[model samples]
Target: MLYGLSYIFTKQATAVASPLALLGWRFLLAFVVMSGLIVVGVIHVSFKGKRLRPLLLVALFDPVLYFIGETFGISHTTASESGVFLACIPVAALLASAWLLHKYPTRLQVIGILITLIGVIVTVLAAGASASLSLIGYLFLLLAVVTYALYSVYVDKASAYTGIEITYIMLTAGAVVFVTMALIEALEHGNPQALFSLPVKHPSFAVAVAYQGIGSSVLALFLSNFAIAQIGVNKTASFIGISTVVSIIAGVLLLGEAFSSAQLIGAAVIICGVYTANNTFHRQKRQSQIEKKSD
Candidate 1:
């Protein structure tokens, strides 16, 4: 939920602050807080051999590259369109998993994915006729989706090697990347007129960045890692829909955004599809266990 709210606040901040600046500051704050945890004996780090290198890479892809891309992409697109498109990430992950595992989805699963896809398309088109965004921006958003899928898979794979610690390490690495990029951008563009000057034009924007840094980057990553540990990757991935629903509510209630009946219906269908996708796996796993016991 914190992760979902971060997007809303981030979009708000992006209105007043440069995307790179916002990202840099958020990660810088997260990095400092998390690193303090490491030093204070609240958290521990292990080298853990070469086995968990992929977790670091996934971090780089996700909170690092994906964040930067999505921030800029949202600048070019409407919030409604971006929200709907982002919700389709789980569908993409499911498709990617099917291809990589050579595990053809059951008929029911395919139907669910199709329903979700249709809902996403409906939401996108119903948002506005001028809903079109630049192709490059959309491509960046797609890249964000691709990395999100990879992040989902990798977090699940790396769960055995100390879940919370591993997550903190990966986030720390991502923070380092963001900080470096921010510093480079600062060097190129100059000192950004000082942090004190930030509140003069946009106090809300400053508050949003602080919330994103502490709540989303640090705390949400911790919760996600714990959730992935408790439930398997497929189950965790299904819950990505929760973030979509949260985003929709935030848009309607917090942002005073309105949607057409078509979009509402589509959202409902997509929610159903998400439920189906999750339950299908649960049923199949139970059936396999039952057969094994009978044998």
Candidate 2:
């Protein structure tokens, strides 16, 4: 739900402030809030050995590239459309695992991947035919999904070495990157004050930033990590499909964005494909683990 609402907030916020500026403020606030928690003993932070490089890489894939792509993508495309694209994350991750980890997928997973690709093609063609979607926007959203999928893969490895405290480190690194980029953009535009000024221009902008920083970034991250720890990553990941529904509904209700019938059908197909691919892989994985245990 938080992740879905983040797309809405990003769409709303970008109307007032540029994508880079909003991301700068969002991560800055997230960094500050998380830092306070660490100081107050609400969350402890620690790092041992040479885990900094992997943590930094994870940050690079996530809030750095992911947010930059996502915010700009949402600005150009409808929130509902962007959400449908994001539903492709699992498919991207599945392919990435196969390529990087050499874990070949099952026949069902292969069919699911093909279905996901067909759905994407249909969605893009439908949107293009309607003249309501931007090609650049879809590309950026695809970048966001790919980068996030990389983050999901690498963070699992990095966090195992750095502990859950890696979340704070990743956020901090992301904060630094965003703030620097924001400043650079401000300077390039010859409006050095815009970085701080734009965010305060309206109450809605501030609220958007707060929700993104606190709710989506900090709270959502912690809750997801906790859920994964409790129920395992596969079970937790299965819930991601719900975010697509939430995002589409919120876009229509809150932002008054309309989707064509074809677009809606495309979104449904994408969701079905994602769910099928994700669960098939997880089920096969579980069975493999059980077989190994018996062996």
Candidate whose TM-score is highest: 1
lDDT of 2 by residue, 139-230 (tens): 88998999977776666556454334766766787789888888998899999886687666777888899999999888887676555445
Tell me the tens digit of each residue's lDDT in model 1 across 1-295. 7876776897788777677777777877778887898899898877656476767766776787778667767767766666666766767666665665344556666666667666666665677645655787787777778877777667656755666576676667766777677668766777746543654578877798789888987888888777766765555565676565566667888888886798787678768876776677788889999999999
lDDT of 1 at 31: 80
For lDDT, the strongest prediction is 2
lDDT of the candidates, in the order given: 0.71, 0.71
- Positional deviation of residue 294's Cα in model 1 after best superposition, in angstroms: 9.5
lDDT of 1: 0.71
Q: Hey, what RMSD does candidate 1 come out at? A: 3.4
* Cα RMSD for candidates in order: 3.4, 4.5
State how far residue 138 of model 2 sits from its true place (Å).
Answer: 8.0
Could you tell me the lDDT of residue 213 within candidate 1? 80
Supply the TM-score for candidate 2: 0.75
